[model samples]
Target chain A: MRPDWIAVDWGTSRLRAWAMGAEGVLAEAQSAEGMARLDEGGFEIALLRLIWPWLDEGQAVPVVICGMAGARRGWHEAPYRMLPCAPVDPQSLVPVAAEDARISVRIVPGLAQSRPADVMRGEETQIAGALAVLGDFDGVICLPGTHSKWVQVSASEVVSFRSFLTGELFALLSEQSVLRQGLVGEGWDADVFLAAVSDGMSHPQKLGSKLFALRAEGLLQDLPPASARARLSGLLIGLELVGARSYWLGQPVVLVADEGLAERYAAALAAQGVQARLLPARACTLGGLAAAIGQLTTAVSGTGRKA
Target chain B: MRPDWIAVDWGTSRLRAWAMGAEGVLAEAQSAEGMARLDEGGFEIALLRLIWPWLDEGQAVPVVICGMAGARRGWHEAPYRMLPCAPVDPQSLVPVAAEDARISVRIVPGLAQSRPADVMRGEETQIAGALAVLGDFDGVICLPGTHSKWVQVSASEVVSFRSFLTGELFALLSEQSVLRQGLVGEGWDADVFLAAVSDGMSHPQKLGSKLFALRAEGLLQDLPPASARARLSGLLIGLELVGARSYWLGQPVVLVADEGLAERYAAALAAQGVQARLLPARACTLGGLAAAIGQLTTAVSGTGRKA
Candidate 1:
């Protein structure tokens, strides 16, 4: 089957590419050479290494890339499109001229807000994909990962959004901070997590003190590792929820994440008496990239315009 | 000059020792071998390495140690004393048996609070030292460091206290987070810092968003390094102040730190309309240990009890 184009999520640590035909995914490939590890002129080679088997001798393959590849220090700087705009705009695509004609690459621009001063690169792609799942949806879409983003989508456009350092904070606390002593476990305590969410929402100011308490609790009372880990995670996530109440309160929420992470968010929201629907994992980023490509294809095929 | 006893401040990263006599004239020494580095049976050797010159052969000299040396994993497991107690109890000192008969060692116990589940190892000494300067200060004492502590002292007893990770957060965010890009300076911005402090105190939940803004503001608006650094510090400290409102709302605040750090806290508190008086650096730690020793001296000399 002849492929139309490849959708790529090129993040900081890794890259995943899917060769999509007119029907569906023809082939999928990935690589460890993410944007962070590759230097100037390395991106083209890295992309080719993974998808070389899928390319033809003379044909050009459209590869739409999102995430860190669009960062200033990445392959090419795709300037951010400010918020209160369409999640994916055809005008925002930044083209990267590939040395090999077999690779035609374009990177999607990220989103930025001015007043609160927040930015999102890859998560915006997921936001675009979100619109595909729920056409004309008006609500909050939360994409949780290393950097969790709570986006407000209304009328097929992102009115505003906030990025929380919750995931990073949880990772840092569990691995690097004093809390590491008692947080080495895969087990979790749901009760502790829910209670923690209540505490965090009620007394947002007690966050710093609560963080230290995890370590103290472990030391003074020999808190179980599972409880310690769960408490630490719940505390941070709860802190984020308290901060992001404006985004989800009385608003429909659509969580976009893998099953585990999304369920975590759903449970957290449930604890707060809020119902949040979940979108299939990786649907948003892929759908978002595909949606963006659809616009380019339309512009290119219907009229002579930049794709 | 020969000293009466040696007062040592041993912490996670370094060790500082002072040879104290009845009079003021004495000697001081320091070493990089803090409690964190040494393994089992390494504490005695590390101590002697720094303070060996002060010892008289075969004559046992009383040595008082404070800080992390009393941590459960430190030189010896010096149990933490529960709060609503004296800063340092004579009975709470854990005696460390030294191979060298010339070195008679006593380690001070740290303070712990139960309700909020918090603990402090070294700051209690600083609290005691504060009492030395401001006799019977019935107010709050702010000890700003890696883990800043806001203590409530009344009638010469530590009634209650709270620990804030403000200093640690500043170090991590400035050196490890994305904000580090715009925080490589020794500059200060009074207005920006004051505004950020106000925001932090007024809306503590905005911490997650405000943190991301440091990086975004740098990328979009070309924010200055000094202002970025100042804003980050001010925000964390302000959030802590917000949580610790019960300690310093209308009560007096005594800032105990080195001139520069103390001045930072003083400035931050002044922005909140709270006047914080500054104390000489390290005086509290030394005085707190001295005060505790006075209790032992009175017990041994007057009551013929454990010295």
Candidate 2:
């Protein structure tokens, strides 16, 4: 039986599922239930609700799931596959067997680094997608998201990567810290933000102590919240830039992210005199999955195996 | 009437009031609550309570206040006099007339920067003391406290200075933010703290973002909380170092602070390759107030008047 759907990317806080026809043409798409909404019911029930609208009366659709859905706490625990190798194909994907379910669902395992003991659930697909699109670009590919991943891709494979909690740090600081008192009502000051970045770069040693100065200087001197927020942002981003620099110094870097994050990275790169371009994350994910599927189909044909 | 005794010193958290004899011997020492505690009671009441104990036994001892007690919300709100000027003396201090009491009191105002509108309530006294002792040292003097002040002293005149909010940031970030989760059981990791300082100094741009990385990385990689806390401390101190470098770049620096704060500054300065000597804040404040008083008395006597 030929499957109607091709891929699905389910992550913490969000979910995305795409449908493809026999020729890899995106026939139709449907999404309703998000991963954040699913808690009690298992993956089978959740996946069914998401794809039920696009399903025919009696058609069995094979769906491949990636991201947090593959984590230990997700629908089913898909084991981690280390780096220096290609991502597993859809057919070779791990199956979640339910005693009372009829639909077949496969989940992709996440990747882990032994030395750092770091594990990533959704970034692997994005890296795989980046590799598929770039063909064989060496150096580091930074995937910035809620948890930003700095992956080192060499020889067409993800050699190693370090995850910097940049986004989460921003969220925590902006919304939670005393620095929150210094944030403006709406919009951000690019000039202030950039200046803060410069300040961070120039006085990296004073980074830790200077944070309080924001409040002291701003409060005593009455610096505007927008400027304070910008400084806070600059301070955090500056720290991340330093860590990321150590990993990919003088290397051609490709940032895989959405538009907003891409712009932020671009600004940061410009400050450091490094050029970076943003590659659409979803497109790369699709391309990478397609490549994985193509490899699997070719292998099956070469082995003369029956479906 | 000559006061029985004079007690004076500027503290970070609180202003110290003293009951002294004509010989300036310590008769009785009392803390008039704390600067942090003054936010609620309106400065007048806070000041009265500090000297209330000394006013017992039907003796109305004339009281003099220096430090934060001289700020806008303080007792009389003495205006800040800029640098290249002598500290305002108790005799020449601004008098706050009590509407319903016979006890006379005066409040000494702090110095302010006109452009930035930055003001220091208690630091001026310490600066005066540093001047009294050194008389002519052309170097940067750092007064480390809750609101640490880094002032440039040149031949008995303050050229320029900047304040860093290092201590407060540490308090807020460690106790308030989600980073608290990572710092729950961890005491203090000097190595981690120092490493964080280096990391902060190297990449000031990313300092702000690196905070949340503590928790996220901990959850994903299980980084110890003590290490996270140390990183936080290091980050803050590193930032301070960055800011302080400009002021203390090539010149010698004298760090005037209490024992605990002095040690912290010493560690941070040593890490940044800057030489610093920790002078007790209490002694400096006393010395500063004494010098200011001596100058004020001389000015009054020379003008054929008495305070």
Best by lDDT: 1
Q: For this target, which candidate reaches the highest DockQ against the unseen true structure? A: 1
Backbone clashes in model 2: 35
> Model 1 misses residue A67 by how many Å?
0.5
What lDDT tens digits, residue by residue, belong to model 1 across residues A1-307? 4579999999888999998987778889898999879987898889889988888876888899999998888998999999788888866689999999887889999999998788898888888888888998988999887778889888888989888887777766777676788887678888888888778878888888888778788888888998887777787788889999989899899999999788878999998788998997576778888988888877767663432
Task: Looking at model 1 chain B, report the run of 10 residues with the lowest lDDT sum.
Answer: B298-307
Proportion of the native interface contacts kept in model 2:
0.47
Q: Number of the top candidate by TM-score?
A: 1
Candidate 1 deviant stretches above 4 angstroms: A1-4, A26-32, A45-56, A303-307, B304-307
Predicted candidate 2 versus true structure: per-residue lDDT over B10-127, tens digit per residue: 3435656666655564544555465545663455565555556555444445555677666554555677767555444445577767643536566567776654335577787787
Query: Across residues A1-307, which tens digit of lDDT does each residue of candidate 2 receive?
Result: 2346557888766667777676664543545555555763556666666656556645455566778887655788787777665545444567767433345567777777666545677777777788777877887888887667888877766778777666765675567554566675667778888887777666566654556566556656777877777777776666667767765578888889888778877798787888886798888777666655555557657852222
Model 1 interface CAPRI class:
medium
